[model samples]
Target: MSIRRRYADCRDGQIHLREAGDPANPTICFFHQTASSGVMFEKVMARLDDRYHCISLDSPGFGQSYQPGEIPDMRFVADRLMEAIDDLGISTFHACGHHTGGCAAVEMPRAYPDRLESLTLIGPVLVNEEEKAEYRKTFVRPFEAEASGEFLMTAWKYLELIGAASSVDLHCREMADHLTARDTMPMAFSAVWNQDVEGAFRSVDIPLHIMCSKDDVLWPLFERAGEMRPDAKQSIVGGSDFQPDRDPEGVAKALGEFIEGLA
Candidate 1:
């Protein structure tokens, strides 16, 4: 069964979370990417429901969540998320993140290591300042040309192409619909520009699992993550950018085995 919850009085403002499985069980929170929301994890959650209490939230300023006038940097976003976790009364939980969400997960464990049982990152973006500046100029700026209509259309088309090429599911296609290309463009660019994954990894001493798709557009990103955290275990999925979405059962099985090994 699926249940949706909204917390309007969160420290960082209002947020929406979609949940599955038993609340009393140990929790596993999934943080989605820049242009996506908790909905992308529905299928994954379904597969893991028997083993985990899964919850996925739309980050502040994305999806149904309230956006503060000022966009938060990665650190601030992590802080707000910790507060949201406290609001949920969850003392300790496993955290999994995708793309930008992985940046937040890295920061969260660094800031509050005591609250996390383990951390998992999928296709993370960990780049240096110079590379970040170049990304903004080359990719982000072009995408943000129009704040809405045309930009969103083009962005969706790009996502469709990626999904088609990767063989991702209908759920991924549907979740991609909620994102406005330009609306998230700024945040996406800023998050990558402002990330300090190496520093964050160094700050937290915890079990880390990094998963990547070999053929993904973000494959280089996972490689960067692996290089930064040399000791962390890495798992490579054989297909497309949306490996977790494309192979939910495989991803879930890998994740479960990883978590069990940690235990």
Candidate 2:
């Protein structure tokens, strides 16, 4: 099925979305990783649309979504996302997020417990107070665009470092997302870093799925996540960090099976 790009209104502004499949099917709302947009979930949405209604959102300050007026915490983003989802008339749905998006997902159960049916976290940043402190120092502020256009290479190199850009095409695609949200990308990262994601993860009382690829940078945290929520469903897919973009088949299979099993 073809993906339809649209916008949903929220208190802040509009949230850009890519949707597919029949609305009659159970819905799975996807949240993309930092510096990327809902476009990252297109392939996976296409693969799973037959079994589920897929709605992937471009979080506030990312992609085509409105930029946040200030550097907000993950909770703020999560609440705004649910507002957009509510605007779409989805009363209940599954929530899946990657990295930064995962941070926002965990907060959803706390703020809107009745709305989320389950939570799926892909390569979530599970860090302690000390670790968060150190990591927050890495991106204390956003990078300034250089006049010589060298900032473009900086963004490309950053994506490569994170395993999000594995090829020329992928790099180009992600680079555009990075530059498009250049001002707020760092703010998003800061929000994730500042928030207590580990605490938020522990607070989720509903069904949960924690996933990561072996080659993903957060692979080390996969074990830690399992230890925290041993009862949660888990899967290890084949891909770098950008699994939905690079390994949609594996992602869709794992995600579809988990969601169906819950039913």
Candidate 3:
């Protein structure tokens, strides 16, 4: 399948997207994790092929996209997505998000319940206020430049730990994104970190699928969310948190089946 690079001006900011499949088919939009861009879903979109009209949005300040004048939250990011899809003349579609992108998927459905046919979230970040506070402390904020290039090594180390699926290409992609990031990584992290994740997802009435790698750090959140929404399907794919890139076929198969079931 041919993946096309595209862009659109939204209310919040400009968004760059990678899209594939037939336009006539039901669209399945993707959202990437914090500090990461739509490229994370490239393999998944490729695997889906002509089965669905798949597109992955580069969140404001990530990838080739431009950030808003001010800081953006997950809800604001979700709104930006709505604007983009509206401009494309798409009325309704499914949404799939990984990590921070999963936060967007949850918020979008809550903000506009009727707009989504279904939702698929991979390694969602859904934690209470206390947990959020703890997560913030784990990070060395600002990620400023250092003379010793420790920041560069830090990025490499972080990506390596999270992307233990042993995919050198995946680690390289994430590392390159981190190195080129424009301080928006922290903003994106705060968006997901400080989000009212529980409340946003608890009210979702649409068909939902929560998939996570068994070895993922967010496995607990995925498990809890599944329990919270017993009606939702849960799939445990083998890999690390970067399962979408490491095992795109599994992710695509699960996502494809979920979207197909909605028909």
Candidate 4:
């Protein structure tokens, strides 16, 4: 099926999106990880092309979207995301998010529960102050200094190691062209640092799913998500990282099945 590329202008900046499937069907808005964009959902969207209306958005400062003069807070990002959905004339929809996007998803559902049908969080960020500090010390801080060429190169090599050459090359080139070490790195760091996962999750009461790779670096955060939403179902995908672009088919299969069961 053909995918439509669209753009929405929000208070922060222009947000790019990729859409597919039937609009008449229930919509599933996908939010991707930091440093990644809607393109990461290419495989998943293709698999779900016949089912739900799938819309993947490029958050401000990512992909083809324009960055704001100053990065907005998570609540602000969530508001703009809802605005994008409003622009599409979608009233109620499901949401799936990964990493940083997952954090935004939690905030969105909390602030506008009426707009969401359900939520699926994949490798969401850790919310508790203790867990957040640990994540920053172990994962975010170490990479802070080497987050330039080396970081991108490492990501490219990891994808290559997993035999995801096409995704790696395309996504890497996109990140290199649009993202900069000077701006995005600090912005991403601040966003995560300033995130309030506990408060956000506490405010949400919708059906929720938390999924992550068993060996993912963000597994700890996913665990925290499970703890935060004890009522939500959880799943594990093997042999993948935060994005899991290489295993999109598996991700789509699991998500589609879960969504189907929900219906």
* Candidates 2 and 3, the one with greater TM-score: 2
TM-score of 3: 0.95
184 in model 3: Cα distance from truth in Å? 0.6
Candidate 3 vs 4: which has more lDDT? 3
| Model 4: lDDT to the true structure | 0.74
- Which residue pairs clash within candidate 4? none
Query: Which rank order by TM-score, best down to worst?
Result: 2, 3, 1, 4
Q: Name the best candidate (by TM-score).
A: 2
lDDT tens string, model 2, 1-263?
88888999999799999999999999999998888888889889989998889999999989999988776788889888999999999999999999889998899997886989999999978977787777777664545687898878777787898776577888888988988888888788888888988888888999999999999988988889999999989999977889998899999999999988987
TM-score of each: 0.88, 0.96, 0.95, 0.85
lDDT of 3 at 50: 74
Pairwise lDDT winner, candidates 2 and 3:
2
Residue 148, candidate 4: alpha-carbon lDDT = 58
Question: What stretches of model 4 exceed 4 Å from their correct place?
Answer: 134-182, 242-244
lDDT of each: 0.74, 0.88, 0.82, 0.74
Which order, best to worst by lDDT?
Answer: 2, 3, 4, 1
The global Cα lDDT (0 to 1) of model 3 is 0.82
Tens digit of per-residue lDDT, candidate 1, span 1-263: 56655563477587678888898887998887766777767778888888788888877777677776655578767776777778888889999998788888888876786888898888877777777878777555545545456855566566765563354455445435345434654765576676776688666678889898877677887888787789888987643656666778767877788888986
The per-candidate count of clashes, in order, stands at 0, 0, 0, 0
lDDT of 4 at 221: 72
The number of the candidate with the highest lDDT is 2
